[model samples]
Target chain A: MCATCGCSGNEHKLTAFLAMKKPEALTGLTVATLPPGARPGVQSFAPDTPVKTVIELERDILEKNNRMAERNRGFFEARNILAINLVSSPGSGKTALLERTLADLGARRQFFVVEGDQQTARDAERIAAGGAPVVQINTGKGCHLEAHMVHQAIRQLQPTTDSIVFIENVGNLVCPSMFDLGEGRRVIVISVTEGEDKPVKYPDMFRSAQLCVINKVDLLPYLKFDVQALKEYARQVNPQINFIEVSATSGQGMETWYAWLGL
Target chain B: MHELSIIQSILEATTNAVQQNGKPGTVETIEIEIGELAGIEWSTLEFLWPAAVGDTLLADATLQVRWVPGKAVCSDCSSSFDVRRLYDPCPGCGSHLLQITQGEELRIKSLTLVDKPTVAKAPLRWN
Candidate 1:
């Protein structure tokens, strides 16, 4: 008797029974007859028999995304757009910084925004209210934004030439680090409320970022967050990273931030 | 997880390769190389593999992975060292200004395929 879905003896009966009752088991069955002069236990390939072939690819797994990003880069370069990708952990005050920046420099520069969130149009609404054209991308179950999504957003927004496009990435630090959004600069936002060791803990984000914005400086007086230590840690991970300390709510250091933006 | 997306990309690439190669044969094994600094969790990838490859060309194919270690060279001291994490400073100069030389790879190395019996096509030519 067979061990699984027991059907004894006759080979044809056993195959038919398993095919009807447990079709998956049929996959493991070798019902084909052997070729002439082929031994039962030993294997031999005839001169004309088809053989296994190994195809060497050695191709990057993210080739598709990288190609798309290059296309985006070309698009931005042709239009003279300064594309900035903002990445951070959730509740790190990315929207607040954008809101303050838009409010302060709305008269001086033309700004376009691409907001990414797991689910919501709230950030896009806020950007629109600030008088800048914006598009919100709901990733559904996606943890990070890809270049293709930003390309689509740019098409929808139809940003003019020589403008700044701020792509506020989905508020996740891990997965976003691996994706290149073809941005002119990649800024990482971290508030004083979070741990000072965030840089070392999530080194990939800091290592890839060009600018590190330390937000919520207004709340520094009440908290034990060491600003110097945070800066040191960030430097350890990324020696070339520039820092700009700001409090979006108190409007402190906004001028420096604007200056960094060349506005 | 990002690994799921990576798996999907692998599947798409494999499918495209098969189509481009004139629908050669059924895949037997796929070999991949993942670096330590690639930002992928191997455990999560393993756990999600079956579901991600189900009903795809890679369903019955065996996955063979090769892990690559991280390596970096310090700019200030001009010394090379093994890097396990990006936060690791240069051992010689204690400088953070290090250039990564390796261990960021996420690539498909090769695919082994068992050819179909009916097709008598010429051998594939590689440049």
Candidate 2:
């Protein structure tokens, strides 16, 4: 039975990735390791008098995640950390954009990145090459980055107060939107090569994001994507959403993007 | 698949619910409420139920999922209405500034369990 809620069940599994060199830095840090669930049959037995009992437990299944998210939120608030969760589909140029951002302001500002992927640490390597302290989280079989994982990553990174921390979620549009990593802001990246109606198709992602970045704009001259129509579609879903078009490769409209970040 | 993980969570939660009651009995019925905006596919969950609970305490337990439709309220005009999708606009004001009032629920409602036999059912002799 769960101590928080009177539910008797196995614990949901999670995997946390942290590489400690000295091992002393790990002191005081309680890493939530997600190591890795099924159904069973019913056995009926003769009872003297069958007693049927109904237990009312209006417990939210996702409550555990939410509770961890609140803790993360408090941690960020106490430290004055600006944690941004960047989400989008695979190949949406999330890493490319991050590389550019790091290369541009890495020397001026102390930025720490928590890179989430299903398998490799390639993205983390790229961010490090671009001149930023980065940690890689490999969520094997897990579709999205849960708050508990982020909390562990934060403890490992130990980002400086008032510094910027970017949580590049696994390239998924659906599941990442549902799980909040206690980010100060959520930015959804959409490329011109993708369908313009993505906002409508993935309404939850667009609705939850505070900003929508239209990446790969340099390819706009070649591709037949309607930029205005895409923005209009996004607005139909979230009236208060902000947008910025940029080409991470050509550095086009990067200043505007940086300005929005208040760097 | 994410659905697989969701099934695991359900099984774990149900098991916990059963143990807390202090009665030895396999689960008879497990009821859960999932809202439309909760981002779960009902058919998929239903399809994965059997394999998920194959040999656990709830193997023969009946699974009941109550789907709650998405609903929202218009922040601009204070209009309450049912929302089919997150992008739905206010019916009265047609404003995108709508606050979600309901839906997006994923919870374990209740569990029904049968008492397990503690001793043989033979008639008790007068003491």
Candidate 3:
């Protein structure tokens, strides 16, 4: 019985063909060409012959991606670059806050932006308007930007040493939490329009974040959202979570926000 | 969802294992260990496994996912306990400082393959 699809046994076949019609490809190739376990000395069994064998390979599934992330971290450390991963849900004003940040601190420090989205270079354009080099990575169907994508973006942007690279992750509260993009710190941005329970609702994102920016505090008087309650909820999820309330529109509390970034 | 991508990874890992050890037959069983904190949906993985592994060496392979429970150690009290959620506090100390020791596992443990049987004929009487 086919456990996955409930298909009968007659259709599913495990037989594979390793046809090397061009033997020269094999002769000239080094050990790198073979799949990990099929190294030259390590035995490779044919799938056509009937012999019961168990292959023991205790390997981490995310190890490859994590290794790439470590490589990115090494790159960042070597260059003395402060990489910050900005995560939040859609319409959380991440872009507006970033715009204010670049304009206010542009003269003090160099900035590079790695904009991630499912479509459009719109965010990249906005960041570039603020006089920073930006690389936009369209993830297509991917929900989050992986470390490798950020590494590629860094190669393209090549921000100078001691510069700050802000990686604006895809507007997702869940998927981006599991991915480590070699950032020195993770900042989660939330707006006043969002519910105070957002931290508890998406505990993973809040717990992984080092700082939380409660954006759009200027509208606090008109809205029913309680800022203190939101902070308390966030703290309940992450005891070490630091907060900065700001409004990108009115430029409220942006100084403290910049100060947190050591700008 | 990202489940599709994860399934692809699992398929790639399985293929590598099969190519290394499978003996000219079919894969019988594949055992994978997934922890509670791996953030994968079990039903979604089960739904996508068939289409993802179809036409590959992992076709018809029995996928056995061993779910590992999340375990953590409290930094303040040094008490070990189960972690049901990301924000779960230490039972003894109520501290958020926790070092997760397990349950983030996403690994392929082993695979069983049945190769083509090599039948032995009676030894030749005449030399």
The fraction of reference interface contacts (C-alpha pairs within 8 A across chains A and B) present in each candidate is: 0.67, 0.64, 0.60
Model 3 clash count equals 13
Model 1 TM-score is 0.87
Ranking by lDDT: 1, 3, 2
Best prediction by DockQ:
1
Candidate 1 structure quality by residue, lDDT tens digits, A36-107: 445323232222234677888888999999899999989999999999999999999999999999998888
Q: Write the per-residue lDDT of candidate 3 for residues A92-183, one digit (tens) a residue.
A: 99999999999989999999999999999999999999889999999998999888899899999988999999999999998898788999
The C-alpha local distance difference test score for the whole of candidate 2 amounts to 0.82
Q: Residue A227 error for model 2, in Å?
A: 1.1
RMSD of each: 9.3, 15.3, 12.0
User: TM-score of model 2 relative to the true fold?
Assistant: 0.82
Q: Where is the poorest 10-residue window by lDDT in model 3 chain B?
A: B118-127
Inter-residue clash pairs, candidate 1: none
lDDT of 2 by residue, A10-117 (tens): 332223333233456545433333223111121222433446788888988877777888998888889888899999999999999999998898877789999999
Query: After superposition, which runs of candidate 2 have C-alpha atoms over 4 Å from their true positions?
Result: A1-48, B118-127
TM-score (all chains, Cα) for each model: 0.87, 0.82, 0.81
Give per-residue lDDT, candidate 2, residue B82: 97
